[model samples]
Target: MATINTAVLDTFITLTGIKPLAVDVSPVLRERKAALLSILPHWEGAEQSGIFAENFFPDRSVGHRKKELDDLIAQTGNVTGSTEIKAENQLRGSFMLNCPNGNIRVFFTLSPENPPLIQQLDFSLAK
Candidate 1:
């Protein structure tokens, strides 16, 4: 059994070229992820006001954000399919919105507030 375990470990390290590190999910990160997930539905529906009303930081310009949202909607058209979270962290995240035209990549940053608020938002075509 010990020999088999050692052989398996050696094979894994050789194939991967690196040892895996244990990842610990922190509570703050969990909170940020929950906040982001809560807003994604509104984003998929193109509810600009819904997304911005509470989730966005108060200091950001609402008018500018609205314009950006409108442009994103115009480019993507209706969200004909499910939205996917591509990557995320305590302060930033990327999402893939499935649309009639194509998949659109949405990226956002969060403020350091307790619950965290969106400090910046942007979108791009997925390629």
Candidate 2:
């Protein structure tokens, strides 16, 4: 029997059904975009918020990094590129942004589940 089966390929096709794989940045991008679109102006309630909450423990100083994320979203329009696989369970995705301020890279890390969570999000301009 083949080591890899059709289910694997089928999943890829289904998850990325909307767009061709060659052009589809990533399936997680779809989930992120969908959630953001629905909860934008109020992303705190988005499904992905749980992922953020787990990663960025809220501090009392101010709100969590939600505001910072908001700012980044405003700057970086959308994902106009492909997602890079850092590991079997991690992926790196960049958006369509050109900031003299700083270059941002969103690292997505997997939980026990198949759908990963947003891990480290930084926009440090300092080299």
Candidate 3:
């Protein structure tokens, strides 16, 4: 089986044609929680909140991320260019997007269940 990080990178490259510069793999649960805390407030009661929360938990479900990725595919039609893997694991991994010619932002999703977080998840810049 492919390591989760490799899987994510592979997926991104296959779909978008871009290679991410950095891939942060959460070594422990605490770090993931901390990362979640930083993002939770913005999505507290939004339509996608539940999915977002689910990605942060130990399970690392990707239901939300998949939706986002699908949407991106629909919107962009293509996925290559400049990118960064903000976070990654068996659960969710975020991206710092430097698209063909657009702005930069962070996109994260919990597991394969959800689509990859896309422009909507773009919160400021990837730290």
Candidate 4:
């Protein structure tokens, strides 16, 4: 069993190279994460369009994005649970919003400004 484990680890290292060192989470990242979590409930409820407006980057077409999100909400049903897919960095991440009808995978990127706003957001049905 020990030999098997060693061989598996060796194969992984060969295929993927050495794993990178973990980065320390910064204060900015914590704030961004808090901002995202605070808005998730509003997203689940789908009641406050203003929340979306406020969080999204001003340069984006907020109305269009809201409409797209609304359509997704309509199709997916109520958000029953959520899972973070990727949130390694301060600037961008992806998450899965589980619903009764289906799951929606959301990808987002944040602006480089001091208080980073969501610069881009996209959603798709999870496979």
TM-score of each: 0.51, 0.38, 0.26, 0.57
Worst 10 residues of 1 by lDDT: 44-53
Residue-wise lDDT of candidate 3 within 1-127, one digit each (tens)? 4699899988988999786565456443234334444444333433444434432533333445445444544444333433435455545555443444343355444434444222124334323
lDDT by residue (10-62, candidate 1, tens digit) is 99999989955534544544454455455543434334533333645465554
Between the candidate structures 1 and 4, which one is better when assessed by TM-score?
Answer: 4
Give the alpha-carbon lDDT of every model. 0.59, 0.46, 0.44, 0.65
lDDT tens string, model 4, 42-97? 44432342223354645555466566766887898977877744665667677778
**Which one is best on TM-score?**
4
Cα miss at 105, model 1 (Å)? 1.4
lDDT of 2 at 45: 63
**Superior by lDDT: candidate 3 or candidate 4:** 4
Tell me the spans in candidate 1 whose CA falls farther than 4 Å from its real position.
1-60
**Model 3: residues with Cα > 4 Å off, grouped in runs:** 1-60, 83-104, 107-127
Model 2 accuracy (lDDT, Cα):
0.46
lDDT of 2 at 17: 71
Best-to-worst ranking by TM-score: 4, 1, 2, 3
